[model samples]
Target: MGQAGGGASQAQEPTGLNKLQHIRRRCTCLLPLAGWLMTCAVHAQSAPTQSDFGGAGLLQTPTARMADEGEVAFTASRTSPYTRYNFTLQPLPWLESAFRYLNIANVPYGIVPNSNSQSYKDKSIDVKVRLWPETHYLPAFSVGIRDLGGTGLFSSEYVVGNKRFGSMDASLGLAWGYMGNRGDIANPLDVLSDKFKIRPGGFSGTGGNFNTSHYFRGRPAFFGGISYQTAWQPLILKLEYEGNNYKHEPFKNNQPQRTPINVGAVYRLNRGVDLSLALERGRVAMFGFTLHTNLAESPGPTKLLDPPPPVRTQTPPTQTPQQVDWSAVSTELRSNAGIEVSKITRRGREVLVTGEQQRYFYPAKALGRTARVLDNQLGADIDWYTVVATREGMPIVATSVHRQRFDDLLDYNIDLSTFRRSVEQDTPLPQREEVLYRATPKKFDGGFSLGFSESLGGPDAFVLYQVSADYDANYHFTPNLWWSGGFSANLLNNYDKFKYDAPSNLPRVRTYVREYLTSSRITMPTFQLTTSRQLGTDLYGLAYAGMLESMYGGVGGEVLYRPMGERWAIGADVNWVKQRGFDQDFSFRQYHVATGQVTGYFNLGYKDVTLALSAGRYLAGDWGTTIDVSREFRNGVRMGAYATFTNVSAAQFGEGSFDKGIYISIPFDLMLPSSHVRSANIMWQPLLRDGGARLNKRYTLYDLTSDRDSDLFQDNLQQITE
Candidate 1:
C-alpha cells in the first residue's frame, strides 16, 4: 500500500500542475507578438495606428485609446492553441465592443470520432470603456473585461493606458484572473474579502455572471509594451513584456518562454489593411491581418439619383385649371417621389393621392417630399394634401397635411416641433366618378443576389460554407399585401464533410443541420404571402403563411402597440410550425410545435442604446426569456449582444451552458454615396442547442413600422431639404 501510494502521488503532481482546463472555461489564444502594439480597443474620437489590431505585442491586450466614431474592424490571428476571429466596433468616443470566436485547435468539441477534425469554437464578448481621454501630457486610460460569458476559458480583467510621443506609442497595464499569472504581486482586492485572496481554479456556476469576487484578486501582474515608427513610414517596430509566466496555463500546458521579451513588426499592405508578424515568448511565430474601415469616412462609389427637382421654392399656381397636363405630373411623381399613383381625385378643398409607396422607407418622408412636388404643380386652390398609403390592397392610415404647413416644414420656414402637430389622419372616402387622374398599378418586381453562405461554431464542424445564388421576386396583388419568394442554388460547398450528432440530453432539434446542408443543392429558403396593416393609431397587425425559413413551414400572426414618436413599444407574436425535411424543399418532418412571445422594446435614448426583451414558449418546448441590448451609431452601425435563459439547466442544455450571441447590424448606405434600404445583420451564436429557440417568424410589426419613431427623420433631416 505504501509503494502504490508513493507512485500515485508522483503521477498526480504533474497532472494537476499541467491540466488543460480551457475546454470547460472559455478558450483563448494568447498569440500577441514581437513588439507590443496595443492600440486602442475602440476606435472613436481618435485616429487609427499600425497596430489597430493583431500587432507585434499580446494579441488580446488593449491600450487606453479609441478609434474614431463609426469605425468597424475585422481581425484574424493564430497561435498554437487558438485561432481567433474578432469583430470590433466603436460606437462612441468612450466605448468599444467586440465579438470573438476562439477556435481551440487542440480539443474536440465532441468525444466520439467524426470525419471532420474540427476544433472547439467558443464565443466571447469584449468591452473597453475609456476612463480618460489621451492628451499631449497625460496618457489615455481604460478598463475592460474579456470572456464575460461562454465557458470562461480566458476570463480576465485589466486597467490599461497608452501614451504617444512623436513616432512611438507606449502602453502599460495591470491584469488579474487569466492574465495575472506572471509576476506575483499583492492582491489589492483582498482588503474587501478574504475569499478573494486566492483565485478559484474553475467557476462553480454557469458562465455569463460578472465573477466579481475573483476580479483584481489573486496574484496581480503588470504588462506593458511599445511600438516605434521606423524611417520607412509604412513599417512599425514592436516590443512588449508581459506579466504571465505561463506556469498555470489552462489545460496543464505551460508554454516555455526562453525570454520575457517579445518582438515584432508590421507592414502596411494597403490603405485599410495591415499585415503583422511576431516572435512570441522567444519561441512561437505568430501572424495575422486586419481589415478596418471608418464607415462614416468610407469612400465607396456613390449611388447616383436625380436630385429632387432642385428643391423647388416657387409659389403655387392659382387656377381651377382643367387643361393641366396630368400625365406629365404622373411622370414627375415616378421620377422624383417614386410613387405609383393608382388614382388622384379632388374632394372639396382636399386632394387625395391614393397609391403604393415604392421608393422611400417611410411614408412620412415620402409624403413630405411628394407634397413639394404637388406644390410646384397644383393650383393654390388645393389646401389639404391627403396621402393614403397601402401595402396590399388594404389601406394603411391616411395622413392628411395642411398644404401650407407641409411647405413650411419642408422649407424650414416653420419649426418641426409645431409643424408635426398640424398633420392628422382621416378615414378614406369612397372612389367616385370625380377621379381626375389614374395610372396602371405595377404588378410585379424582382431582383437577383449572390453571396457566400456560412455557419460557424457547430459541433459537427467548426465552419461550413457554400457559394450560393438567389433569384428573388415579389408579386404585388394590390399595394400592402405581396407574395415574396426566393430560389437558391448551391454553386459549391463542402457540407458533405459534416457528419456528427453532438452528445446531448435535450431533443436534437438543431443537430440535423449537417443533413440539411448536404441534402439540398437547390432550395427555396423563403416563400410566403405576407399581409400587414396599421390597425389603429398605435396598434399594428400582420399575418403570413407558407415556408418561413430553411427549416420550417409555418403560419403566424403578430400584433404590436407602438405610439408615434415614442421610444418604447410592446408586441405579441404566435406561430404553429411543422418542421421541414432535410431536403429544404416543400416537405415536412415529424417534429412540430407552436411557439409565441410577448416582447417589449425600449429605446433608452442614451448613446443610441436600445433594449429588447421577450418571454414565451420556445420551439423546443422550453420556457424562457431573452434580453437583447444594442448601441447604434450616427453612421447607422449597430453592435449588440443577447442572452436567452430557459428553465432547462446548464447540464441539460449542454456545451454552451446557455444560448448567447453577439451581433453587428450595419446599413449598407453608410458606406455608399447614396442610401439604399438594406442592412446586413451578422450574428455569432456559440452553439446550436435546442434550448430557448424561437420560431423564425418572417415579419415582425416593430421592424416594419420603424418609421413611426421620429428619430430616423430627425437624424437625417438634410435629406428632406431636397
Candidate 2:
C-alpha cells in the first residue's frame, strides 16, 4: 500500500516514493483501456439470475454475465447424492465469488476411523471475473476457476462468453478437470507445453492447498446453455448441455449418465427470493431456493423511534445570554442532538460546546441538529457555534458553523452550497474560556443482550451451536479510564456433539476450541481495565490488562498515528499473554507466549475498498504476514476477507494450508427503528488451526477515534437535513 501524507510517511522507507511513482504510471496507462471498456459496456435489461451452482449462469454451466455489485445471496440445492450449501457475493462490478459446502450422502466423513458418523463434507471456493463487456455486436467474455485452493475433486477452469438476443441469453464454454472428464476435445494448451496434456491426480497431503500446478490440465470438453424469459414475468426456463459424463466422481462413487442434457425452471417468489427445479443426467431431480439482496443501495428500515431534528424558528431570538435556560439547552443537546455534554463555554461572539456524539453514525447529522437547538435557545448575539467533539476525555475534531448562515440555509434564504462554504473543521486544541455550564459525567453503564456461537464442517457433527443470554457492564472512573466485563449464561446448546479435537504440532494456542466450547454452561469471556489518551495531535494510545478474551488473559498496549483527512494510518501493538483455562474463568494454563504486530491501513480510492497489511509474531510463536481487504457499501454495510501466510510449512499448518476468513458488518440502525453507531459483525473461518492467530483485542485506536475522519460525515450527508 502506498503511504498517504502526514504520519503515514514515517511508516515508509525512502524507496516508497519510487514505488508510488511506478504505481501511478501504471494506473495512468490503464485509463484508456478502462474508458474503452466503459464505452462498450452493455446495460442489462434485468437483474442477472443465479445458477444452480450459486452464480450467474444457466442450469449447470456458468455464463459470462455479472451480477450487480454488493449483491449477497445464499443458495441451497439437493440433487440425488449431492447436496450443496453456497454463499455468494458480488463485491465488485466485474467480480463474483462463492464459498460452498458439498455433502456426499453416500460417503462417510472418513476422518474418524471405525466410526460411521457424519456425511462427507467438502469445502471449496470459486471466483469469476468479466474480461469484456458485451456490446451491440460483441459477446461478453469471462474467465473463472472453480473449487480453487481445495481438494482436486471438483476443480475446473473455464473461459465462457454470453450474448443476449431479445428475451434469450446464450452461453458457451470449454471446461477442464471434473467438468471436462468426458474428454470430448483435446487440450488446447498442449501446443504451448506438452505438460498440459499430462494432468496430475489425487489429493495431496491433507488438502486445502491451491494446487495451482494442476489447473487447466488434462482433457477438455465443451458446454453450452441458454436461458429464456417467458411471457409470464415471474418465470424463466433453462436448457444446458453437460460438460462431464460422470465417468468419475469423488470417493469413487460415480453414477451412470444416460444423457448430457439438463433442463430447469426458475420462479421468482418475490424480489428477494427465487425457487428452482431441474432434471439432470435425464434421471435425477433437483430442487433449490435462493435468498438475495443488494446491500449497497438498499434503504434500511425507517427510523420511526428517533426524535425529529429541532425545529427552526421563523423569527430571530431576542433573549440575552443570562436569560437563556442553559440547563435546558444542555438537555436538548443530549436528547435531540445526541451529544453528551461535558461543558458549555463562551468566548466573545462564539459559544463552544465540548461533548461526545453517542447516537448518530454520521457527525453531520449531530452538528446540523445542534445548530438548530442553539439557534432556538440563544440570542442573536451568539454569532458562531463551535463543537469540540470528544471520544473518551480527549478532544478529536472541532467543527465551527456560522450561525446566521446555518439559519439562512434552514429557512430557504441560502442554498446548501453557500452554507457549506461557511463551515470550518480542524483538530481540537485545549483553550481557556468563560465556562457557562460544566455537567458531571455519568459513571456507570450496562446492558443485556443475546449471543450465539456455532462450528461447522466438523467430522463429529455437521454443526454444533449455542445460544446464550449475555450481560455486559462498564464502570468509568474517569472519561479515559474504565473497567469492562461480560458474562454469558447458556440458554440452549447442542455443544455435546462437539467431540473432535484436532492435534497440533505447535503450542496449541487455538486448536483447543472444542474443549473451550464444551467446558462450561456459564462463562465469563472478558474482564478488563483499559485507559486511553490523545498523545499528540494525530497520535492516540490505549492500554489494557486482565482477561482480554475467552481463551487468553493478557496485558497489551497499542499506539496509532492517523493524520486528519489522510487516506492512510499506521499502528503497532504488543501483548504478553498466558492461556486461560477451558472453564473460561480466572484460572490460567501453563503455556505462555509474546505476540506483536505492526499494521498499516490504506483506503484505496476505488469502490470504497480498503486494505490492511500486518506483519507479526503469532500466538504459536510463528511469524507471518496477514492481508485484509474490505469494501463499505453506501448503506454502511461492510464486507471483507483476510488471509495469513506464515513461515511454517503447509504440512505444519495442517488441513487448511493457511488461515483465512471472511466477515460482514451490519450497522445496527439498518434493522432497528432507532439511530445507532454500533454494528454487528458476522465472521466465517473455514478451519481453525494453531498458526497465524492474533489476540482478539477488545479496543483499537482506529475504531475508537473513527469520528475524527471527515469521510463519515461526507458519505452520509443526506442525514444533515433530517
Candidate 3:
C-alpha cells in the first residue's frame, strides 16, 4: 500500500513549485513566437509616413507609396497664410482619398452680404491610385489628382514614383496647375490637345462640381524628395524640391520664395500620432501633426467583462427533460451566452432555444456559447441544438448544430469544415413544440448621451457648434412594438453667431439650419411609435409615426426583401412629412411634402464593398437619385461616400451645387472593453443645401434585419470559441 501511494503521488499533475516549472517550460516554448510578433510590430511601424497634406508622402509632395488599406488619418498643418485640416482614408490597398478644408488667413470670407469677415475657407477632395508596386530594380508608380472637386485655386494632377533603398526613400513627380506654377516645362499632354496648354482661369461654379476640364492643364514642373529614417526609430528626416513657385498662389496672393528646396522632420509621439515641422520654399515655417490608425489591423482590447465559457472536465451524466431545471438553464443561457431567452422548447432529441442576442456582435459566437451552456444543463438524449435568432419579436433565422459534431470541434477531433458540414441554417419552422420555459422582458429602456452638432465653413464663422444634453427613452408595449422619444437641452453653444442663411431657389427644406440652431434652447428631436413585423420568409416591414426628426414630423413605412445569406437586398420607403417650426416645437410650417425612394443595395463581394442606389423625391419636392458606396474593414469599421443629384439646377442649389458627404462608422466594441453591437457614426457634409434633402427616418427595415445575414457569422467562425 505504501509503494502504491508513492506511485500515485508521483503521477499526480504538477502543483506548487512543479506547476511553476511547467509554466516556465510553456513560456520557454513561446519565446520564439513572442520574438516574431515583436519583430512584425517593429516592421509595421516602418510604413510610409503621412505628409502635411495627408496621405503617404514627404512634406507637401506625395509619393507612390500608400498606407495600408482601411487606414484612417486626420491631419492638420499651418504654413503662414494657409491652415489645412485634412481627413484621409485608405479604402483599398492601391487607393487613397482625402478631403481637406483650407483656411486662408489673409483672405476675407466675402463682402457686405456675408455675415462676418471670418477667414476664407475652401473644401477640396483628392484621390490617388497606384499604377504598380515597386520591385527589386523598379520604383512604385502612382497617379493622382489634387483638389478634385472645388474651386480651381489649388487644382493639380501628377504622376509620381517612389523607390526605397534600405533606410532611404526617394520620390519624383511631374505636376501641373498650382504645383507647376514654375512653368519649367511645356505641357506634356499638349500633343494630345491644345486645351492642355492653357488651363481654365478663375474658380468653379459655386464650388462642389467636379471641374474635370481644369485637370492636367498648363505647364508642368518636376518635383522630387528624399526621406531618411534614422537609427532612432521615432524620427525621420526629409528633403524635398517642390515644383511650384509661390507667385501663382490662390487669389493671386503671391508669396516670396528664396528657393524651391523644402526640409522637414517628423517625430513619432506614439503608435498613432506623428508631429512634423517643415521649412517650405525656404521662406515659410510649417508645422503639422497626424493622428492615424489602421482599422483593419485594430482588433481592440480583450473582452475582460465577458463571461467565460463553462468548462467541463468530463461529459456529465445526461438527465431526462423532465428531470432538468429549465429555469436554471434559461438563466444560465442569458447570463453566460448573452442570449435573451424568450422561450425554451424541446422536440424529440433536439432542444430548441428561441431568443435574441443582445450583447454579441456575431450571432454564431452567441449560438456557440449557447450550445455549451445547453450541453452542461441538458440530458444526453439531446443530439441537436437549434437556436432561433429573433429581432424584435420576429424570427429572423434558425441555426441548427449537431451536438456531437460541436463537441468534436471543441475537442479538436474534427476540423471547422467537418463541423460546419453538420451545421444548418434556415427559416424557423411554423410548427409549435412543447415549451419548457418563457421569459418576461423588462418594460422600459432609456439613456442619456452628450450630443454635439456643428456647421463648418459657414459665412458667420469657420465653425458653428452646439453642445447639448440628450435624454432618450423607449417604452416597450410588446415584443415587437415600442414608443420612442428623445429631448435635448442646450448645455453650451455658440449658435448666437449663426446669422447667415443660404439662399435657395427651391423650397427651403434644409437651408433653414441657421434658424433651427439659434431659435431653440431646448428641443424635442424625436417622438415616435415604432413597430416591425416579419412579412415573409425573407421580407421584413417597419412603420413609425410622430416627430421623425428635429426639423420634420410625420409618418413613414419601410419594407425590405433580403434573402438570408445573400449579398443583395432591396428596400423601399415612403413618408408624408411636414416641416416643424424653427423653435422645434409641435407647431408646423407651411411646407409639407410626400417623399419616397426605391433603394437597391448590393454587396460586390470584392474587398467587402457595398453599393446603394436610391431614386427618390427630395424634401424640396425635387426628383433625384443618390449613389452611396461603402467598404467595411475586418474590425467592423466602415467608410462611405454619398452624392445626391436632383432635377434642380446647380445655380438653384446655391453654394455646394448639390448634396454630397462622407461618413465613418466605428463599432463601439473596437474602443471599449465590453462587447457591443452598436457603432458610433461620424459624418462630414461640405454644405447643407435645400437640394436633394431626404427625410431622416428614425429606423429602417434593412438595419433591423441585419442579423438575418449569415456572412458575418461565417467570416468570424473562429471567434465562436472565444
lDDT by residue for model 1 over 315-413, one digit each (tens)? 657656355567777777766676677777788777777776666543455677677777776787789887776545544446787888777776679
Cα-based lDDT at residue 668, candidate 1: 40
TM-score for candidate 1, please give it: 0.81
TM-score per candidate? 0.81, 0.91, 0.91
For candidate 3, lDDT tens digit of each residue in 320-346? 777788888888888878888889898
lDDT comparing candidate 2 with the true structure: 0.77
- lDDT values of the candidates? 0.64, 0.77, 0.77
lDDT of 2 by residue, 506-563 (tens): 7888777667766897888889999999999999999999998878998999999988
User: What number of clashing residue pairs does each candidate have, in the order they appear?
Assistant: 33, 0, 0
